[model samples]
Target: MTDKASPGYADIAAHYRRLIEDGSLRPGDSLPPMSQVKEEFGVSITTVNRAYRLLKDEGVTTPRPGAGTVVSERLQVASTGAARLARIARTGEKYAPGETSVDHIAHLRSCHDPQVAEILGIEVGDEVIVRRRVFVRDGKPAVAAFSMIHSRALADVPELLQPQPFDRFWQEIYTERTGHVTTKSPERRTARLASSDELALLSVQAPENAAVPVLVLVNVFHDDQGPLEVWEDVYAPGLWQVEGEKP
Candidate 1:
């Protein structure tokens, strides 16, 4: 199977799937890293990544930095969900002169995050507007976040979910509709252990062993009328530093 002409990520994914089915690759068996896979299969790094991503999506493997990728112990692929949003930006101690804008929306298929569910005031499987993004610092993944707004609030704005994840600009749409603006003010901050879902998305290895601390930010958006929106929990640590200016 390794001796093939121009194998794609799907092909590599199949090979790994077969290994798992045949018992050659069992749960907890660490698969070769991208470097090794490239050497063995003579494929590009991107191809290897796609293969790994497929395995990851199928609940077959988990990537661990320095330790390589391994078959999931339970073989049950946990939803990555908003765990990626828990990352913090490590640079930019001071805000830039211009306003920073990120116009993107991650569609929430079915989120089970307890905090997320509570913030959006929806059931575990209820549909919501999930937005995930990584604020980069110097071109490196810095702050990773998962944000969800009540589906009811977004149902009328179907165009928000078209063409791409970040289809409609959130601030513009909100202000135009109700003369409100989304404000980000940290109400509280705390630390916690990174979950399995977070470990996978952030590509963190030995998260438990490393004792990585996550900073959770609760940002609220409001209008002159009242509280317009609330992001109950946004988590990150080691990836960002906070700064403020006096008016």
Candidate 2:
């Protein structure tokens, strides 16, 4: 009402945000150079900088050393399409395009952790198969996913012991192997200070041993038999959920 016609830095930020959400500007896609943006928007360089900073803080963009400000890899879900994001949120499925697992580890491990035991519907000391992966986009780590399956299911899903990620979704592999489709996948979300290990794995930037906030998303997958497996995903900083269904 005051001055709708006068474009401001917020307008600049919103323009790029829309492009990112709508898949026009995807993960690792660089934004227009500051000078070019300033010329197109008829704004000062300072104004353009402010807008870029705003986008960066919103996790919509990241500044690369030589590539300029590019879309954040974790936000690839936004660029992939909101419906796809919703689908992934509703059902644990494949990662967005361009997101790849850069590291994978699978092993049989003793499970004495109470929460892990409860999620897997196993005793505190029961052994479990643990599969871990570090997913990245544009060579930057975005999420660390840990999957735990009860040891008894090993015979049914021996692939869980494989060192590499399956060509198909793990959920699909499990379903095909056991004839138990996922009936329920309850998720629990929490925020906590990133651990030293998480900071290193997720490439979180922080002062030496300083606390950095992170979001932990845990999904307990259930089938007709009972709890099938549990996935604990840790997202890097700036990967928190935001409002708006689109993007």
Candidate 3:
């Protein structure tokens, strides 16, 4: 730990990161129990929990129900843009012309969602360039996505507004126009009920009971400086798998 006192969750997360980097801890190693950490760090259980969640979000640790939190086999010490681009590339060029795939539609919209607004550091209803698309695999809709970019960021590149959906990778377009490639891919995966828009986009009949839990991929694209784009992707249940190398 540094001379500065570790105060809150951020401090606790940094402290753990340092331990991992200094070889004080290794991958697959279990962290001390929450009670132990609280005693050692002199922080509350909630603070310790927050720190653990932060590590989990950064892919540094995994929580086991009875065993406690363990260092993840895969530790992403730093955000590298290459990893995300490579993952996208590995998806392969499977979509062909006349494949009955979803189309990208351009629409006038405002960024109002609290989370999105916070990521963009802008107020609600701020104008943003919104691109909507659906992913159809094997003739069935498997995913739906809505990406929002600050209009001012891509204002000069009017060609980005083309009607052809998914024709141009948004990351590539931004990199070419701004000379700043997106390097950070922070993803949030969660399950939730399908909204009316999602139901319409997926072309699925709405169930009378609770909507099935779907995986939502919210990726925030950022450079070393800050965020560039925020994408909200909704995936059908059991339709996709995410695999990454452990190094």
- The best candidate by TM-score is 2
Give residue 91's error in model 3 in angstroms.
8.6
Question: In model 3, which residue pairs have backbone atoms overlapping below 3 Å?
Answer: 81-183
Candidate 1 per-residue lDDT, tens place, 140-226, comes to: 333455556666556445554442443334545766776565554445556677666555545556635566666655565444544
What clash count goes with each model?
A: 16, 0, 1
Per-prediction RMSD in angstroms? 17.3, 8.1, 11.4
Decide which is better by lDDT, 1 or 2. 2
Q: Rank the candidates by TM-score, best first.
A: 2, 3, 1
lDDT agreement with native, every candidate: 0.54, 0.72, 0.65
Stretches off by above 4 angstroms in model 2 are 1-97, 205-209, 242-247
> What TM-score would each prediction reach against the true structure?
0.46, 0.63, 0.57
Where model 1 places Cα greater than 4 Å from the true spot, the runs are 1-105, 162-169, 178-186, 207-211, 222-240, 245-247
The model with the greatest lDDT is 2
